[model samples]
Target: MLVRPHRSRAVTAAVAAGAAALVGFSSPTATAAPVPGTTVATTTTAVAAPVTAQADILDRVRAVPGVTKVTEATAPEGYRFFLIDFTQYRDQRHPKEGTFTQRLSLLHKSDDRPMVMYTSGYGLSTRASRSEPTQIVDGNQLSMEYRFFNTSIPTTPDWDEELTIWQAATDQHRIIEAFKSIYTENWLTTGGSKGGMTATYHRRFYPKDVSGTIPYVAPNDVVDGQDVYDEFLANVGNDASCRDALTAVQRRALGTDRQWFLDRLAQLTKEEKLTWTITGGMEQAFEAAVVDYYFAFWQYSLQSDCADVPDAATATNEQLWEHLDAVAGMSFYADQTLSNYVPYYYQAAYQMGSPEPYEDRIADLLKYPGFNTAESFVPSALRPVVDDTKAMPDVDRWVRLRSTEMLYVYGSNDPWSAEPFTCGREASAERRECYRFYVDGGNHGAKIAQLPAPERTFATQKVLEWAGLTDADPVAKKVKKNGRWSTNNQLDRPEIRGRALGRR
Candidate 1:
């Protein structure tokens, strides 16, 4: 899953403030030679080196083919970091036809340590320096920004010709091949949400590239009709009162007090300066936010929060608006936010099927009925010409039949868990090493460390064993409390939630 920042002014202000604090933690900058046909941005710094000659690593990386720019930066205390841009093919099979340069971040700890390749499903800004898989395993980290995201956009985006899953996997493969020449150690690949799905697709296309993969909260094929998510919503969480309260909140937002909420939404749009290209205008965005409230509640929050929901009849407008803004923020469907996700929408509509919203349940509440399709999330210019002939049944078949040595983690309460890959359970005894874990009561933030007892041990052991780092146990070191695993220390662990539904 992609991890996108909430683009509200509040979030932007917070980011700007935090950037200043990060400046002091960074290492001396080192500028790299520029690559041809690209706008280059470099930061030069100085730092210490050991007998291993860390100083020369930059020069060696620059010598690699297709490497356009390499800049040294500060990394987590134990590692050194560099940002690199490489020239890649728009189509690997027909490379001569065209090319695009993509960006990647390399966090080096030691040459002989294990390596974790994190594949992001969307364009990644330079602000993000680490990934969840990188934190779980003791290894060097390489984070590849997916094609058409942030800095990875093709010179001339031909969505029809350039945005294929195979092409994305190939982009990861070339980076792996190039970096292996230097790292030359055990390699593991992982991602969450769409990124997790991307990692699986990479494994499907090139099983030999990485020894193992851990796709967190990764769903399999998207069941186009809302049937999958509908079943999930009906059964999510452990309390009926909380579920009913959530439904009540949605009804109030869209039904009896809708105009009041719409007036508040309009006032917030002006105060927060929110803007969207949603075809139905502010009213549609308001409706979408109501639909999103149900989704966001389970996706990122604890079920216990639902108990705090007020009854529609007795609740004040401030109470309802406060809960809505906190969970399903208005910024989610803004024009700028939607624009940032055009590439993802195209891919979902074309080859990667997306889950349809449960409109039947909210049919009467919708301002613009039938506005729940994938086409509704994107701008009019990029609406995909959905073709039924090109679904991903073959990919599904391969995952179930041949994918091995993989670990899939999910949350019982997470809606996406409704359509998890069933292959691990269906595979023969010989492929039992391919494990699927569902964290009891966990949400999208569920990780192997959150699991209880033997399950946590088993999940952690499998990943370490696969990465050839059996001696290092992040779960045991961090999660064990009084001889049992605990997830209370979530703030310290790697974040598992990917980009909200939009990127995934």
Candidate 2:
């Protein structure tokens, strides 16, 4: 959901000025003044220039202690980008234990402009040049790569003691404090899926760090058995025919045509030059793919063009294979994909809850009925100790008691949406700032911009108003009618999409 800036300076300036006006800040006007010593000499001062904002913010960011590196990055037009690495403590409370250098990307629009902090729950592949939330808020963007993901891993890792959600939230707090020294404006935090979950966790731990939070498709808690996911699968799509068609496809792939699909999968594996670290080998991986197919079908392909799964009885091998590969391919469950998700699994197993796969529907067709656990999806080498519930209890309490000025967007059809944060009846009556919008018949790809008419307009206005931006009602009206809000096309690819089973 990263955006590349290609805006003209005139547009950037106008937007910045408008944002300032909305937030009750008046931009200083540049005017020439006569010098005191010289009768004819004069000097002009430009207030809030983009160049000054960039230089001042960069200098201040570099000066933050533990910042090991700051390299200039090529960014979209009208913006300055930098890749930064900061030495952070593995245990922030006990700073003497050890340290790890975490990576973050800073996309500076202006020092006086509002800031959008995108919390990436996993390793960031690239600096999200632009994102839906950033566009709606129209501010400076900071994309943080979660610790232990990508190049942010610790020197001597202690997963049991260090990879807690509180530690991750602490990392975000430190970054926000450092950057607040320069930006000095209202800050908004956001992320999608796990990233969205990270945003919620940060707000729970450090509520005052940011002005508002907008978490997209973020689940609040992970149930040990993931019964909610089972409930979600029981009812996902809008049409019964579509759901039945999907069920038929699942049955065909895992039942009558099981061997054929497996052979085709093997051939596809060879053709694609795939490899995996899965313990159950190709057959096991195939089973996982079968299980994944059900989730992926509803999560991504529930759209019109993809939902009409062909009748399995009349479908050719090629047709089935094409649909299967496109929907839930072996590459998704391959070793490479599994390897990158060890940190997520650790978090899920230890503190963050995981959802269990719904096997009752297709149990008769499953090759390994016992493969219901999420642990099967993780690489065996990086097994997690599932005894600790870390910060789940605290986060739960915070959401129930203190969460405010928060906007949560979720899709009605998304499995993750099943466990959205629910405000208690008393809180719902008392809390006006907190809102959750469930897009009707929407899937995982849903965003505030993509929501239909009045809802879309309502969400836009709410978020902008929450971010302290002025003219939100007017802008929301225009954007809603014209479809101007940024859309989130990049979807999360978690190794285990649903709840993890077999909790010890």
Candidate 3:
């Protein structure tokens, strides 16, 4: 249960860098690994003659408008992967305003097969890999980079005007619409964390685009912060000792052991040959790291590890540093890490809300309370971007009243679970089409395969029906295998979601 997901290395690289968010059946053993490709011009090879199925797919990829480049990438058996570049607008409202090449990765099976479109929250690594939904549904996958991220940057960057959630969803709508002419079968959208939220936003704006959506650990966040996370942290690990031990570690690391932690940061930076570029110096970065530790401890660790966390005051520097590094990466706050995640911060500040810092828990320990760590990293000119309070609430309302064929998954230990998309409806009802499941001991990389076996079977069956692939071999093979899987995670059954606050 040790998930070393330090900023996913570079956004959610499709099943490949997912190589962070990519899933391989069970457990959160995913990380984003970088893949290389070029943005060359592309044109459609008209499908006048019906050739082999593989050849026809290439023609369809070319036929899709705005597709500038398509190059083959390594893939697992039975799948052909292509890295694509599509020239998209700075703002969908104004066609002539400008354009930038957005990254797209397609994993093809056949025209008649269902397709799963991944809504990534970060830059697209464009590598070939299937998400949880794609794997279970056994469908082709299309992974697109979010607008203004990595290679998808706007020609004229304007975070305030161009980087809104609606604009990003429109980018998705454009791609999905273009692909509709070829793949007439079922369609589904899925992603984890920020990517999961991206999928939900796409559904909110264009619900009918896909037959269903499966968002793992996605949050429909808003405004300054949500108190749900604070409560989660307070009770994380489901053991009072585990929760107290975590905060105690933070206190010692930031208080009496402050200098020791600083020295370790400097030494590790030099050892790794990395540079620091956070607004505040390494000290402030240290402070941020300690504060984020409350989350990292549970989001990345397991109940077993909680017993191993060194006593902040009693353990040797080596013991403390080992546990710290295991939970949080040393180079997470590095220059390149910040550069890649700057877009995430901008979106969080402008539209997608982030969890407020654990101020009540560690306010006095902080050296820079007024300075928002990630939000402050945004350019000074972009400061004072008003919170879009309506953004999340509108989606939440639509999800409850109008949303259908949607599924949500969360890990009870994941801090992001604090503010899950909450429209409490059951699947047993005829009208309700949404369902949520929690991985017993899962972390941020939770998967449906990890859900308590009964839930896992039910979820996959629902997913198969939704994708119109009812004939797929879900129950025929895995019934005996799932029975042996453990059900209990040794933690209190914390509620998976809370009332996502509006402006708290």
Candidate 3, 1-504: lDDT as tens digits: 001124422223332232111111111321111111212333433335434435656766765666666777777667778888776777778766656667788988777778899865765654466676776666788888877655466534667788887998998988888777667888899887777888888989988888889988876664446546667777777688877888887777778778888888888778766555534466666666666666776775677878787887688877877766555544565554554555676667767777766656677887887454446655444566677778877887777777788888988887777777775555446776887888876777678888877888888777777888654444323533453222222211322221111111
Candidate 1 lDDT, tens digit per residue, 1-504?
322222232343322332221222211222232333333333432222222335467765665556777887766566678888787776777766666667787878787777999865765445435555555555778888788665465444566667788889988998888878678878999887787888888988999898889988876653455347777787788887787788888887788788898888778788867676544477776676677677767877777777677787788988988877777675556654455556666677677776666555567777676564556765565555464434466677767777887888999988778888766455536654577889888877777768887887777666666777644455434533333333223223454332333434
RMSD of each: 6.1, 12.1, 8.1
Off by over 4 Å in 2: 1-57, 271-273, 306-308, 370-372, 426-432, 472-504
Which candidate gets the maximum lDDT versus the true structure? 1
Score each candidate by Cα lDDT. Answer: 0.67, 0.64, 0.66
TM-score pick, better of 2 and 3: 3
Q: What is the per-residue lDDT of model 2 for residues 289-311, given as tens digits with 9 covering 90 to 100?
A: 66767776766544584446778
What stretches of model 1 exceed 4 Å from their correct place?
Answer: 1-55, 125-130, 278-280, 388-391, 424-428, 470-503
TM per prediction: 0.84, 0.80, 0.82
lDDT score of residue 461 within candidate 1:
60
Ranking of all candidate structures by their lDDT, best first: 1, 3, 2
Q: Per-residue lDDT for 466 in model 2?
A: 61
Candidate achieving higher TM-score, 1 or 3: 1
Whole-model alpha-carbon lDDT for candidate 2: 0.64
